[model samples]
Every structure is written in structure tokens, then in C-alpha cells.
Target: MNPAQTTSQQPRQDSPHKRADARRNHERVFAAALEVFEEFGLQGTVPQVAERADVGKATVYRSYPTKEDLVEAVVRHRLAELDRSTAPVLAEAEPARAFETYVILLFENLARDRLLSEALAEGRSSRNTGPLLDRLAALMDQAKTAGRVRPDACPLDLRVVLCGMCLQLINFAERDPALWRRYGELTLQALRP
Candidate 1:
């Protein structure tokens, strides 16, 4: 092959503009999926998500071929956002405050986004939560040591309580929005030593 032909045969890198467009498309797809899933739960279809995103069905399928794939992707995305929001608090020196802040953030996220609440409520297993659970366990241990948390209050108990409260809010928020704040306050009170 000629020298010029050799250069042409090499794979081309995506231009900056193309990369930006891809990023935007990704964001749009993710946002649309969240909305669709929120409105329809796991029964939401890919075509519906694609329509909501204003992109071709092929575009959505290119990233996630099945509804399950889309749901998993959306869950992973939400989990990442949760992790980012809680990371700073988890790093703080005060374990009780950190744990409280983390729980509050979780409650707030669940209240604000029905999609995330649904995703979490589905009880799908994802490996990403292991580290988060470990961190929470460490924080609980610290709080127990500091006399902020009760000796019998384990990390799993905290998770179960907070998650149950959030699920209740999601289930009842349509009838009464006040339930979210009320349950949140009650949760905090119950968690305290």
C-alpha cells in the first residue's frame, strides 16, 4: 500500500465536536430514561425512552440493548451520583455527623427522584454498593464508639430503616408530601442513641 493509503487505513480519532455531541447524547438518553422509568417504572420501554430523549431508537439501543440493561445503567448512574454526594461527608472527622448527613442526603435524593427510588426498591443486586455499605458500616462503628449510635444499631439496621422510610415516602407522597419530611425526622430521631 502507498504511504498515503497506509495513513488513511488507520483508525480516526473522534473530533472534539463529535465527542461533545456524544457526551450530550449520553446525558440526554440518561435523563430521558430516568423520566420514563419514573413515570412507568421498570415496564418503561426503550422506544419510549428514545422518544423522550428525542433520539433514534438505534441510538438508545446502541448503549443499552434491553430494558434491563437500561435500568441497570440508570441505576449505576444514580448510584454514582449518590456516592459523589456522600463522599465528602463520609470523609469528615465526626462520624456521627457524617453518618447523619449521609442518611439525609440519601433521603433527599430518594424524595426528589422517583426513578432512583424505584431502582433501589427493585432490590436488584449491584456490586457498586459494597464499598458504600462498607463505608457506612465503618461510620456506624465510629458512632457506636462515640456514644452517638446505640450499641445494637448495626449498619444493616440503618440501611433497612432508612430504605424502608424512603420507600414509604415514595408510596405515600402522592397523597401527602408532608410524609417525606415527617418520616425523615422520625428516622433521624430513631437512629440517635
Candidate 2:
């Protein structure tokens, strides 16, 4: 196969030069924003993000005009990655198994980065939990229909159970991985119908 004749697979863009600079600036902002937001939260300032990215504050403002805009960008990026990873699982796996696997993957992601976990440790923020809960609740409905999960168990309750377990694991994993592991198994078994 001739390489030149294969395909021009670059992402389609409205303007090549603008896209190039936008991509670079977006990458810089994402990296810095992820770190800074995780550390300082929604209150993280534009100057801090610019310093972390090693770009001018003007660049940060160009990419995100406000702190909420920056948080939205960061959340969008991370949630996009999570969606990619879980799409196949959601589509193809058995409902109960899909839910279990989703929770496990969520725990892994939360555990991998302290800052991300900390940002979401709060019980509020429907923005953070709404998508995840909806996915799990859909799976739970399917599982109940299939007799794979307890018919009486509420999906919302299950979501809370899983979230609470994960929070405990996040808090104590460093101090006691063994204890967390034990509780993890117990929680998983409890979710089984």
C-alpha cells in the first residue's frame, strides 16, 4: 500500500492554523487545569493555571474566560475519557456485571489520583455524579429485569453504597490497603443478588 494514497486521517477542522494553536493551548490548559483544580478545586485561579502551564495568563483567559469555564473544560475532558473506557462495557456486558465493573473502574480511576478524588469527595455536585449514577441505574434496571440483581434493591441506594465504599477506600487505602481490600470484597459480595 502506498502511504501517501492511504488516507488523510487528520481531524477535520475549520481552520488549520487556528486548530493547531487551539490544540496546543487546549493541551496546555488541560494539563495545568487538571493539576491545579485537583489541588485548589473550583476556586483555582487563572494565574495559577497559567503558571503551571508555563503560559501567559492571557493564554489561559483566551482558552477559558472564567474559572467555571476552566472547570467545565477539565471535567469535560476527564468525563470524555471515562465514557470512552466504559462505552463498550456498557453496551456488551451483562447488566449486573457491567455495573460491578463500572464501579470497580471508577474506584481505580479515583484511587490513581488523589487530587481528582479529593475534588469529588463531596456528596454534592450532581454534575460529578449524575452521569455515573444514571449509567449504573440503567444497568441496575436491566439487571433486575434479567433477575441478575435483587428486584427490591433501589439503584439509587446501590449507587450510594458503592460511592460510600469508594470514599472509605480512598481515605484509608494508603494507611491500610489490606483493610480496604477486605471491605472491598465484602461490598462487592453485598451487591450481588
Candidate 3:
């Protein structure tokens, strides 16, 4: 075979431009998957996500080989969003205010994202939550040192409390929309010294 023909038959290298395109496609698929999953929960399928993404199903599969992998990716994305949104609040000089703001932000985010609320409610282990938990622990330590949070209050306790409130808020959203803020306030009070 001619060298030119052999070169043409070989797989093309992923050049910088190709990599940029791939990254854009990956983001599109991820955004679409998050939307579909939020609307339909775990019942959403890869085909549906692909349709929403305006990309081929094979493209989605190339990035995320399985539904579970896609779900995990979406979850990680949402968790990262949560971290970004809450980080500044957690860093405030007033520890009590920081803790309150963090909890309120978390409650709002979880209430808005039904799929994430369900995933968290299921209590499944996720590597994505590690950083969020670390942040929470740091916030809790700050609050404790400032004498705003009770001495016995641990990060795990705060996690459980927040998760419990979020689960209730989600389960009763249709019945009572006001319960979310009510529960959020109650949770805040419970965390105070």
C-alpha cells in the first residue's frame, strides 16, 4: 500500500481543535443529561438525553458508557455547583451567619434539583460528596470554635439533619410548598448553641 493511502486509512489524531470540540460536546451532553434527569428522575434514558443534547446516542456513550456513569457524572456536576455556590458563604467572617447561609443555600439547591434530592435521600455512597462533606466539616468546626454551634455538633450530624430535611421537603413539595423554608428555619435553629 502507498504511504499516503496507509496514512489516510489510519485513525485521525485528536488535534487541539478536535479536543475543544469534544469538550464542548461533552458539556452539552452533561447539561442535557442533568435537565432530563431532573425532569424524569432515574427513569430518564440515554436516548432521551441524546435527543435533548442534539447529539447522537453514540456520542453520549463515548463520554459515559453506562447510565450509572452518566448519573454519577451529573451528580458530581451538581455537587460541584453546590460547592461553588456555598463556598463564599462558608468563608464569611461570622461563623454563625456562614453556617446559616450555607444551610439555606443547600436547602434551596436540593429543593430545586429533584434528581439530586432523590440521590441524596437514597443515602448511597458517592465519592463526589467527599469535598462537600469536608467543607461542611470545616464550617462546623468554625462555628463550634466561635461558640455558635453546640460543642457536640459534628459534621455527620449536620449532614444527616440537612439530608432529612431535604427528603421531607421533596416528599411534601406538592402538598405544601411552604414547608421547605419552615423546615430550613427549624434546621437552622436546631444547629444553634
Candidate 4:
């Protein structure tokens, strides 16, 4: 067969420019979802995000099957942000100090992030919290190795404790913005060996 025939017979591939445009559309939808959700809370509709993204409603649905999925993406994004913030702390010379600082940053992000706080309250993103927990487990393992953390203080325990603390603090959002922090600090203290 001629090379031209072989090439023409093969399935066509998306051009690099088209692929990049698709990616840009996906990202635009992601950003618009977060923006709409923040402006109107998680109750914001997909159409709103489509409008904000300047894409069709089908485009948003194609990117995220449902509002929950979109919110879950945002939740993952927020946790990833928190996880990235702890990267520098992992290099601290003092293992225990690093762990404490990690917990502190976790609590700070959880306290201020309305999307995370609200999602936790509503039981969204219950399935995927890997980025944050993976980092926490690493830190815990390091601290444990140094004999600074309780042998049994696992990442799951920290997650439950933090979730509970954040959920409790959601009630105090209007009354006392700082009240939830003490619970986080107390929980951290309990985890110390």
C-alpha cells in the first residue's frame, strides 16, 4: 500500500491545537464552577457555571457528570492546596516541630476554607481526600520514626478528629470564627507521643 493510503486509512487524531483548546475549555469550566459555587455556595447550578465559563451547559456536564462531582473536584483542589502548603514544613529539622506545624497549617486551611468546611458539613467528597491524607501519613510516619508521635496515631485518626473539629466549628462560623481552632490544637496535642 502507498504510504499516503496507509496514512489516510488510519483514524485521524485530534490536532495539538484542538487538544489544547479542549484542555483550556476543561480548565475554564473548572474555574467557573469554583467561582459560581463560591459566589452562590454549592447550590449554584451548572448552567450558572456554564454561563460563567462561556461554554454550553453540556460542556460542564461533560467535564463533571453532576454538581456533586464538580464540588468534589473543588474539594480535592482545596485539599491539594493544603497538601502543597505542607511541603516546606516537611523539611524542618525537628520532626515533632514539623508535625505540629503541619497540623497547624491544616487547621488554619480547614478553618478559613468555606468550601471545605461546607462540603465536610454536607458530607461531600467523602470518597476522595487522598492528597491531604497522603501527606499527613507521610508526616506522621516521619514523626513516628522520631518517637515524637504516638505509635498508634495514624492518618485516619487525624482525619476523623479534624473532620469532627471542622464540623463542630461550622456551627460557630457566625458566632466565633476562632472557636474551632482550639479543638484542632487539642487534637494535635493528643496525638503527640
Candidate 5:
């Protein structure tokens, strides 16, 4: 083969080591963001995350591009996880148990993910309850049919009740886990038929 022809090549994709390094950096950046957000709320600076991650500020910006983008990405990632965990609860045949379990899982999610709790506390989650309402409505209908919930329990009402429960738990998470646990059951009881 001609030497010049043999030398021709396609551009390289990221190598395995490069990809692994990128993954590690990504995780570090996210971890840093989580810590910063937990400490300073959503207003936490990107530089803070970079410092915490021990990465350059430009690296953080390259990963997230914008503050809102970073916040949105983290929130969505957490919510997606919450959704996956609740999917099984929603699929359960028993309505009351399903609803109760769903709330419990949601409370757990809020308790674990500080950034998510802060976002909820900031009222950013209010605008995105459509899927939540749909799921709750369907579950409530099943529970009603199963004679588990009250007769007048609509999905929207259930959504409001769940939102209230979540907010209450979030407000009380720092002060008292027991309080949230108590109210969690109470809220579930109220939804029971």
C-alpha cells in the first residue's frame, strides 16, 4: 500500500480510559453540586462546586453550561429516580397500599436528596405535577374501586394532599423525622376510603 494512503485515518472517538476519566469527572462534578446545593441551596455558586470537586471552574461550566441547566439536570435526574422507585408501587393491585407506599417512597426521596427538597421548597415542582396527578388519579380510582379510599377522592385532590404531605415532611425533615412519619401516615389515612 502507498505510505500516504496507509496513513489516512478516521478521527478517533474517546478511548476507554478517556471515557472512564470523563465519567469520573462527571460524577465528581455532580457530587460537588449536590454538596454545594445542600449547603447553600440552589443559589450555590458553580465555582463552589468546582472547588469542591477539585476541578476547574471551566470544567464545571463545560458539564452544565448554565446554572439553570445544572439545576434542571440535577432535579430531573433525581425526579426520574423517584419515578422509577414509585412505578412498582403504582403498579401494585392494592390501591391503599400503593398510595401509602408511594408517599413513603416520595418522602424518602425528599429526605435523601437535599437539592430536590430545596427545589420543591422553592415551589419549582408545582409547575410539573401533571404526571404526578395522572398517576395519583389512576391509583385513587383503583383504590376507590377496591373500597380502599373515600368516595369523593379525586386525583387532583389526592395530588394536593400528597403535595401537602411532601411539603410538611420537607419542612419537618431537619427538625423531626418522627413528625414527618406521623403526618405521612395521617395523610395516607385521610386518603383511605
Candidate 6:
């Protein structure tokens, strides 16, 4: 190869590395955001996440411009995870058990995840809730057909009950992690046929 051509055509090796570094930074910021929000709910701050991730605030802002944007992203990611976890519960042989298990799982996750709990309780960013709702509704219907739940049980009814439970549990669940499960059992009992 000609010397000048070789020099002029030298690949920008740093470009790929820069892209990979950017992706790693994004993943770090996302994981940090998840941890911060899980602990602090929506009250968590980008600066706190940046500190946790050991990245600059500008780095987080580069990928997520605002707090709301960051929250929406986190919520979407969490919802996807929650949805994935439903598969096993949905596959249970007994309809009532499936419904009850799903409810308990939701309560456990909410009790442990302040941001998701708060977001759901406050009814913000509801678009991503559709799939979970559909799955829950399906389970509820199966339970109803199996003569497990009370006649009036509906998906909205569960949401209302869940929101109320979250409100009651949010303040104390951290102190007593099992409290949400207790409430989940009570909620299940109340729904019995």
C-alpha cells in the first residue's frame, strides 16, 4: 500500500471504543437510577444517581434530558421485567393459585420498589401498564370462572385495592418488609368466593 494512502485511510479505532464507552455509561446510569429510585421513589435525584454511578450529571442528562424522562425510562424497564416474571405464575395449574400468586408478586415488588409503587399508585405513565393489566385481567377471569373470586371482582377493582394497599404499606413496608405480604393475603381473602 502507498504510504500516504495508508496514513490517510487509517481507521478511527477510537470511534468504536467511544461508542462502547457511551453504551457502558448509559447502562451504569440506568442501573444507578433504578437503585436510587427504588430506594427514594420519584423523589430521587439525577445528581444522586450520577454520584452512585460515579458518572457526571451531564452524562445522565445526555441520555436522559430530564428527571421525568429518566423516570419514564426506568418505569418502562421495570414494567418489562415485571411482565417477564409473570410467565411462571401464569402457567400454574390452578387458576385461583395463579391469581393469588400474581397478586402477591405484585405486592412484593411494589413494597420493595418505591418508584414503581409510587408511579403505579399515582397513575403516571400508564401506557406501559397495559400488558400487565391484560395478564392480570386474564388471570382474574380464569379465577372468576373457576368460582374462586367474588362475583364483582374486576381488574379496576384490583387496581383500586392495590393502590390503597400501597398507600397503607408505603410508609411502613421498609420497616417491616413482610407487611405487604400480609396485606396481600388479606386482599386475597377478601376476594374469595
Q: Number of clashes in model 2?
A: 0
- lDDT by residue for model 1 over 65-175, one digit each (tens)? 777888877767778888887787677747657766666666666666676765554333346445555666676687778787788897667767766776666666442
Across 1-193, the per-residue lDDT of candidate 5 in tens digits comes to 7776545632134467677887899899998887787556566889898999999988888788998777777776767777888776677736556766776665566655666756654432353434555665676677677787888887656656766666665565563545556666776788876
Q: Would you list the C-alpha lDDT of every candidate in the order shown?
A: 0.71, 0.67, 0.77, 0.72, 0.69, 0.81
Clashing pairs in 2: none
Give me the runs in candidate 2 sitting further than 4 Å from their true place: 1-23, 38-45, 114-120, 169-186
Tell me the lDDT of candidate 4.
Answer: 0.72
lDDT of 6 by residue, 35-80 (tens): 9999899889999999999999999999999999999899889988
Off by over 4 Å in 4: 1-24, 38-44, 118-127, 141-156, 174-181
TM-score of 3: 0.77
Worst 10 residues of 2 by lDDT: 5-14
Model 2 lDDT vs. the true structure? 0.67
The alpha-carbon deviation from the true structure for residue 179 of candidate 1, after best TM-score superposition, in angstroms, is 4.1
Cα lDDT tens digits for candidate 4, 56-138? 99988888998898988887787767667777666764775677677776666666666666665543235665545566678
The number of clashing residue pairs in model 4 is 0
Once model 4 is optimally superposed onto the true structure by TM-score, how far is the C-alpha of residue 10 displaced, in angstroms? 21
lDDT of 2 at 57: 89
| Candidate 3 residue lDDT tens string, 1-193 | 8899878756465466688889999999999999998777677899999999999999999999999999988888899888787777666647756766776676667666777777776543467656666666777787788887889998677777777777676666532435566676787778788
Runs in model 6 deviating more than 4 A are 1-11, 123-125, 172-175
